[model samples]
Target: MAALPTVQAPGIVNLSYAFTNEGNLLYREDSLNYQKEVFAYDELNRLTGWDIYDDSSIPNEEHSIV
Candidate 1:
């Protein structure tokens, strides 16, 4: 299957993403918001947790899945 390009909302010109060899999303960055989202996977490549950072004002914002 062909990989799809990442899409963002209108007027959001600064956006990027990173993926693993298995096509797993590793991280996403949005320069307009000064934020970055990171993903984590387990041995089986299953989503384990994730973290988000907002450098605009707050130090960091994190979220996890169990």
Candidate 2:
């Protein structure tokens, strides 16, 4: 995988990643580091929404299908 440009919005940091061979974006991670909210996408390249994780990487809350 390759790291792409990182776009910073109002309250979120958008990180894009692409495949090494196909150059297709495998997924993206959107996060508010302050809030510990992270959103993960799938191969379809859509926003599968977020899961709240603490510093320990434990899932606290999740939002999907949005």
The local distance difference test score of each candidate is 0.79, 0.55
Per-residue accuracy of model 2 over 3-53 as CA lDDT, tens digit each? 555667676565433343445443344555533555556676666776665
Task: Write the residue-wise lDDT of candidate 1 on 1-66 in tens digits.
Answer: 355446567785678888888889888888788788889999899998888888754438667778
| TM-score to native of every candidate shown | 0.73, 0.38
CA error at residue 33 for candidate 1, angstroms: 0.6
Cα error, candidate 2, residue 35 (Å):
3.4
Worst 10 residues of 1 by lDDT: 1-10
Off by over 4 Å in 2: 1-34
Error of 1 at 44 (Å): 0.9
